[model samples]
Target chain A: MSLSESTSRRRKKRANGVEFTAKEFKRQWILIAIAAVYVIYGIIFYYLPLAGWIMAFQNYKYKTGITGSKFVGLAKFQFLFSDAKFLQVIRNTFCMGALNLIFSTVMAIVFAILLNEIKNIWGKKIVQTISYLPHFLSWIVVCGLVHDALSSTGIINELLVKFGIIDSPFQFFASKPWFWPLVVLTNLWKETGWNAIIYLAAITSIDPALYESASIDGAGRFQKMWYVTLPSIRPTIMILLLMNIGNVLNAGFELQYILGNGVIQSVSRTIDIYVLDWAINGRNMDFSLGTAAGIFKTLVALILIVAGNTIAKKTGDERLF
Target chain B: MSINTMKPKKKKMATEDLIFTIFNTTIMVLFTIVTLYPILNTLAISFNEGSDAVRGGIHLLPRVFSLKSYKTVIKTEGIITGAKITVLRTVIGTLSSLIANALLSFILSRKRFLFKSGLSLFWIITMYANGGLIPTMVLFRSLNLIGTFWVYVIPGMVSAFNVMVMRTYMAGIPDSLEESAQLEGAGYMTVFLKIISPLCKPVYATIALFVAVYHWNSWFDAMLYNRTNTKYTTLQYELQKLLASVTAQGQGGGGGAASQTDATVATVIPITIRSAATILTMAPIIALYPFLQRYFVTGLTIGGVKE
Candidate 1:
């Protein structure tokens, strides 16, 4: 039979309340085949890894493999709690993550509001374009730029010295006290513009009639922005904040890894970096211990996401799930 | 308009709005300067004479201009190999990922596809719950993907986020278009390739640019899997290695015996070369930005607000 004849026959069968005909299966076979590929890919790459998390409980060794490794139960978890450095790493991760979330979110919102208020389209476009360019550059490049700018004799110090703000050049990267602030500032500089794009989009979707009504009520520019614009985009803000809460432990490994030095090691080593150090670069290469840390981070993130989603759902805001 | 004309009250509002505009413009200008200055400063240092750059007064322009740093960086063997590998992977990776993601998204977007929900759920679950770093690395190692170029191309062949965005975009396309093509007895592949694919150029370009940028900028995978294999090292990874060396040398109290060979070049700063390398690493992405700007912005707004 021709393809159309078979399709028509299948349609007739379907109309007659019959199901699972060979012709029906043949018609949808292409889609099924495509989906099968994705399903296999997901199983191998995604689901297999979840199973591999079993290594966290075992004394995993490359020679013996995960299945052959002796089961050590909660020994690795015990080690994590006993290790002071690991505890410090966790603290560093949370502190840096919280600071990053607060500063980046606030700056993005403020930048979006300011950009929205600009009447000159060309100026707004130019500023927005320039601001977001840094986002395209990798952390390696951003760290390189930050390093150069904060170097002892770099432009920052030159200006400070010339203005007599400081008597001499200060080593910004070397100081432990300056590490967290620098991380926060770098996060702000790299992400504020890109993050603001969502807020800007949200602002554009706000009803223009609301602004007009506010104008008729003798509302000034700031007053209209405060009453009409901010409230309108509050849902977007809440949703983004909730999502960011899930990532609070993922303070990131790259920027800290690149910019960190022995001087600021205490402040710079995040949980991901801690995992890399133990799993890949440790003296004995403790795979099981590293896997336990990895499992911990993932579980916390999952819990946070679930909690955030539940809260958002309850409050009738936006839920990621 | 009549009320404003009768009261002549528009002047106060105009003045207040003007002040607001002035404040906004000033803040934006300052921000632009801050963002642009670092890049321009690095550019200036790259061009300046190494000795002059070390003396530290170069701001916006080169003091004693020379291409020595650029020449040195271009001549490095690792950089050349790294660039070749980076470009090769980016082209291969972007093309494969775009095709894979496009196919998956197209399948999902079709209303006739029976298991769309099941397939989407399979991918979306991975987005929220991952095996994390160690297990994923172990899986890659076990597959023998650690030392091969395919490692980069294969693992990222299909991203759930890109699939979601493309699927949403494809769903927005009217079903009548696909039905018309199907009425002419076109198969699914023909309907997708000849009809729907052409119509999705904007979203395709958007996702393609994103995938390309990701492949270009990726270094973490190289640092992990390709650590032992220098042949597969990417440009970004090479730059990172160079950065580590520079930092190490700085901490070790400058070039120990290396500066003795060229006494005249002793004053030449290592940072000048590093800055030039940094510029070389970023130059391609910066160059591609202007052309890809419109598509990316459209993609962001669509993916951001709609999703």
Candidate 2:
């Protein structure tokens, strides 16, 4: 029991709470019944749905559920900002989450620095195992392979009408300005080889003697990948751009709910398909205006992840938690 | 440091590293043929000939071969009950979320677990808040867990980012191997079933290849709690209801083989039975993707470098 005397007797039995003493309930009642079955399955599935977020200030019903509904405080966030399709579903969830966070983080850092300049280790592990085979398929099989690769006789309109670049064929899911660059090129073909395996494991853990001291100071190989592997993976690209600016409002919900239709439904809806079309697929179920637009998208994704982890801890970087 | 000044700086860095290794091996062989040309053109339009794969130019291979869309996706009784409820929820939701996230990451990597930081801030406020989607579908329709099958094995077991990636890989082992198995009178479930579950077999093979690829790429919790439960339907929600009935018959007959030369779109569900149900939902993740691709490339760099 000597890991610092079992962490100083668990900080004096967590400051003597609930006073357990039968030899500390016979060595912590089977570790308090295995952390009380995940804190009672995190209080019946994550804190009883944050107590059904008070059915977004009531007016909810479903046979009088949230303790006989009808409170209606902020009038379902004032009819979700006087709804113009909830401001075109918050400008299609901030322009497809900022063009899928700037072209899937610049095509997964330019395909992990051009597959880390290939020098054939089995052709960079068979092109990084066939580039994460569309990152484990299903957004309903990547919208059935993005509607058969943008059909109009697919293969991107049979190579843009065989390089004539469009004499015909370019419906691209009935183009509402090609629905946000076809949802950022279908999220860079299902996450550019699973987001370039953490910048190719931070460019293969850098220090090959800083690319042999930037090629003995002459610096070739793309200037030692721009002066030694992009300044040693600039704090892993500012902690993955502070977790992609807290998922810029999670710009996806099964690829705009499986490539939204009615000719790209107003640039494909998003705020989780406007809170599953006003609570569970419309016709006015309106669970308090879909729990007030899912509590304004979980309070603006917990204030953009605590304002991008307080601007990555005041720009020191590497901050998520 | 001078073989005649490193022989003309190694022949002017071998002609600029042979023109940057032939332009980085031709952009990694044209980005691995544009990431394997849409799963090999959906396996050559799922072995073509569903009305000759809707008249378009099928690619990779099959121009006229025919399995008749894998015998209409194996004589679809909703694709064989959504492939027996997506192989019984990807083998019981990846062995019950890999033994409930390695028994709550071995009780939050017990250095001395007295409610380890208030149970790690109660599962890290469920990884940045939830209760979305209408108060989690009105608390899963008041905990009936809506059209059950334990709503796909109980609301995705436990996860605070897979219990902070198995409590940061069981807090990097060696607390003198759980204090020499608590001085040999081993308890905490017999030193987590014999010394921290056999030193967490490489984080239980990286959280069982991330909970068996999130229970075989979940189909939006069987399209939101078994939408009209065809007995807990799955196979990616029957390939999203055959890709919303071939995108509403290619937007009311503009194309998809000119809406099957119209005898009411020749009883829809074509494009070679949605390319043999998208190659039988990604042929068991490309046949267990090269033995779970080195445990999900060290489980996405240990769940993308968390603390």
Every model's DockQ, to 2 decimals? 0.41, 0.20
TM-score of chain B of 2: 0.39
TM-score for each prediction?
Answer: 0.92, 0.34
Writing each residue's lDDT as its tens digit, candidate 1 over A1-321 gives 112323453464446563456876798798888889888988998899999989989989889998799998999999998999889988989899889999999899999999998877888888988888898898989988888888876888999999999999998866789989999998888888899988998898899999999988988889988999998998899888887897999866788888776656777788898888766663668888888998889888888878988898899887775
Model 1, B1-307: lDDT tens digits are 7885746567877887788878888999888888888899999999988877888888899989999999999998878988999999999999999999999999988866656556777787777788988899999989999999999999879888898889879978998998898899998999889998999999999999998888889898987888778899899987877776644345333321111111122232377898899999999988988777778889986654466
- In the order shown, the chain A TM-scores of the predictions are 0.92, 0.38
Model 1 accuracy (lDDT, Cα):
0.83
Q: List the residue pairs that clash in candidate 1.
A: none
Q: Indicate the worst ten consecutive residues by lDDT in candidate 2 chain B.
A: B256-265
Docking class of 1: acceptable
**Model 1 chain B — which ten-residue stretch has the worst lDDT?**
B255-264
TM-score of chain A for candidate 2?
Answer: 0.38
